[model samples]
Target: MASTTIQRSAARTEVEGAARTERPRGAIAFGLTRIAIGWLFLWAFLDKAFALGFATGRAEDGSIDFFAKGQAWLNGGSPTEGVLRYATKGPLAGFFQSLAGAAWVDWVYMLSMLLIGGALVLGVATRLAAVGGAIWMALFYLATSIWPEYNPVVDEHIVYILVLVGLAQIGAGRYLGLQERWERSALVRRFPVLR
Candidate 1:
């Protein structure tokens, strides 16, 4: 009887080993996708930081005012005629518009871009970055949504946000990011669902 039990266990192990040997389904593809997504955020941050000149359109200022750019677009050659004015025209618009040309605006925009883009590329606080990225993309979508032909209905930025959200939901960082360390920490382990 003991011999028979041992034989059965060995058979089970063999079967499991065989299953493990089977080709994995799209693992490489998924990893590549994640890396590509990270690259996107990295590129965006770099592009805006060095070349695009943030929201202020003041590359000389060396700061990024993300919202300021939108404002400029709206007041200037923006396709979204009243959208920016309508949303920002209230007391809030007046307040931010005041800061539009200010140096502080550049600092804020640069910092925000760095934080959001850095965290996303590194996969640290992935869920947080994902949510933030989504909001950012949504705003862009709003700006572009006003014009169908020039801006179009579909944008890659939106897709990247969605992918970020999905990866965060699955804790994709565990496989290849700081999220693995994050997840194992007391903060995450205690909650077990924080991420």
Candidate 2:
């Protein structure tokens, strides 16, 4: 009877240990998704910062440089102009349009993009980044709300906002990011909001 009890206790401990270490289903997929979205933000930052011409460059050959000579933000190019001019269509269209080419607006937009992208890519301060990204996406969605041709009231912005929120709720950074170290840091402990 003593031997049986010991065996049962040991078996239960082993099972519990395994359960504690076991990853949730689809963890890898979720991590990959987070990385992919992070890359999207990072790529946008790179494209705009360097004007590597994905969509903002002009070639000396008098043709649009789809791959080079773009109007880089550092080179005094306004990233908000094109989108604000063409994509804006809601009741606040004029408001956003007026912000185009404004120096302060340009600086804020560029800085926000860089910070958000960097945080997401590095998996540092991801919850904060997600909140900022969601707010940014919400603004874009509101500015471009005229969209029956695309979908019935849902758009890329809304999808991105939802994804950001989901990532935050799931503590996605903890899975494969620097979140473990971040969470253990004194700053995080001192300011729990950073976690």
Candidate 3:
């Protein structure tokens, strides 16, 4: 009985000492928050990419393509001109109109959606993804601002972007993601700028 008590005391002391040597109390909590947000991004991408039925509808019914319909809904049935007309005024309207039907414009928009969505969800380049997501949301706001129902002036997108940015800036991935492994590699050490 005496030996068991001594062993218990020693174990308790070791645990206390180890706790004292750990990082800040908030690091683990913050890492968990990062994991949650990262999952949100990943889910968003998966939902849209697979047509798990979001803004575009089901993926299997040939309804995964939301870009064209989104642009149309923002505009006035002329997919390209609608959003621009809503956001641009006077002289800027002409400039925006010129690019409304540009093929590259749609391509850029689609690619941005894919990349930003992928990055945020994967927690790979979260900072870049968050920034890009913000820009995308901002443009969406611009396009839909004309009407309350069409735009609503507020949405979860803003919150998502901010959270993503915060997570990236804090290097949350280093604590709760593959980024932790990536950060320790010789390649990352050599390219310190990657962080």
Candidate 4:
């Protein structure tokens, strides 16, 4: 009877441990940072996609309109056309410009923003999101200013990359996000990177 009791206790303990995710004291900080970075991507996507006019979809009079049909992606405005064609200044200008206004490229960029932002914000698939977001930011850095005025080898993109790596390394998503439950999912078990 004692042996059976011990076995039951052990099993119960194991299940409890598995069900309870531990959050470090610093979890809040990392989770907040993740949300902030995610918002950068998400906000950009919203502004561009809907032309909210903080940066895009401005009228000829420089007035702002919510969901204005003039320059929104929905209205056929190209999210990247102005930047790639007119604002690209680095040695890769031609390359960047070549991708300007292409419907397919716009779709890809928009989708990247939505997916990466959503993943990071929701605290699921953060590793994959970090990888994809880092690549996207790096490309943006390369296109706009290969030789940044203030620094030769560092910029916001690089900082973001470092933070992303740190987040992945520490499992930032597990702290306050849905990461623990997400990892227990069978699909994530099969693909650890999705964690």
Identify the candidate with maximal TM-score: 4
Off by over 4 Å in 4: 1-21
RMSD of candidates 1 onward, in order:
8.3, 3.7, 8.4, 4.9
27-69 per-residue lDDT for model 2 (tens digits): 6675676677877777777787777757567566767554343
Better of 2 and 3 by TM-score: 2
**In candidate 3, where is summed lDDT lowest over 10 consecutive residues?**
70-79
| Model 1 lDDT tens row, 1-195 | 999999999999999887754423554454455556666655654544443444234544566544344434333323223334444432345543444444454455445556666665565666776676677666555443423344455666567667767766655554445666776778877876545
Tell me how candidate 1 scores on lDDT.
0.55
Worst 10 residues of 1 by lDDT: 73-82
What is each predicted model's overall lDDT from 0 to 1? 0.55, 0.78, 0.55, 0.85
For model 3, what is the C-alpha lDDT against the true structure?
0.55
* Cα lDDT tens digits for candidate 4, 1-195: 999999999999988886655655677999999889888888889999899988886777988876776568887788888888987877899999999889899999999999999888988988888778888988988898687878988888789988988887777777668888999999999988687
As for TM-score, the candidate ahead, 1 or 3, is 1
Error of 3 at 150 (Å): 11
Tell me, by lDDT, which candidate is best.
4
Deviating ranges (above 4 Å) for candidate 3: 1-53, 57-101, 146-157, 185-193
